[model samples]
Target: MSFDQYHEPVNELSDETRTFARMIVSLTEEAEAINWYEQRISVEKDKQAKAIMQNAQHEEFKHFGMDLEFLLRKKTVWRETLKAILFQNGDIVELGKEGEEASE
Candidate 1:
């Protein structure tokens, strides 16, 4: 989807929500950059750059999905609506704190 499709006027959102919206916009831009890198690697004849770009793109996609989830959860919507939107994908669990080890 185009950025224009998701773009809303700043005045439409409260100050705190506007901050979150800016983060979403920034993340979307980063995702697009990663996508462009992936395409570039696909066309380039170099093998090493292609592998690097592929890995980078995967990481970027993960971050993008996480950011989207974070922003959606912060919105003042019904519980059912939130569940419906994010259900069947996965729960938005947080990672362990710094220096903390995984329990599993």
Candidate 2:
């Protein structure tokens, strides 16, 4: 679906809604990490780990989408969420530093 589909009406959200949105985003981040670990487990020959990871991935995927919707409901930008994710991990900052060092 388009990003616009996630747009939440401004008046519909209260402070609690904003707090829930932030929580969902946090959960999404954790799910992403779990999903990554599951992928790594899938690479191994352990059938049990693979199955567990597969289930976790599916749940996390759903949670991520729902959380995105929650943020949109709060009139928050998807790009802002993305930026928050990246900035929280220092990815953007590290990339910027790498770019500057490479140009020198």
Candidate 3:
């Protein structure tokens, strides 16, 4: 209901840009859900409740990954940068710097 995600006028933006913004919001919401579930699971007294929260968290994680993949598919430089940094065994900061350079 809230159109708070857009910094520009909605009428001025293309459909693709609007969809991209919506997905960005979705990604953020999924991340927040994951975090909330993590916090709940950490302090939950009931094992069953914790298990349910964990399951829900897993779903959120999947959504987050999917949303990220969608956005990455839309941006070539972002995809290239992440490829340089992700799944690599090295200093993260260094890898990030390398990724930035590689993308350029």
Who wins the TM-score comparison? 3
lDDT of each: 0.64, 0.63, 0.95
Q: What is candidate 1's local distance difference test score? A: 0.64
Which portions of model 3 miss their true places by more than 4 Å?
A: none
The estimated TM-scores of all candidates read: 0.56, 0.45, 0.96
Error of 1 at 85 (Å): 6.5
List clashing residue pairs in candidate 3.
none
The CA lDDT at 30 in model 1 is 74
Give the better candidate number (2 or 3) by TM-score: 3
Q: lDDT at 6 for candidate 1? A: 36
lDDT of 1 at 17: 68
The candidate scoring highest on lDDT is 3
For candidate 2, lDDT tens digit of each residue in 36-82? 96768758688887778777777777777676656656644544445
Worst 10 residues of 1 by lDDT: 95-104
Candidate 3 lDDT (Cα, 0 to 1): 0.95
| Tens digits of lDDT, candidate 3, 1-93 | 349999998998999999999999999999999999999999999999999999999999999999999999999999999999999999999
RMSD of each: 10.2, 10.5, 1.1
After superposition, candidate 1 runs with Cα above 4 Å error? 1-13, 76-104
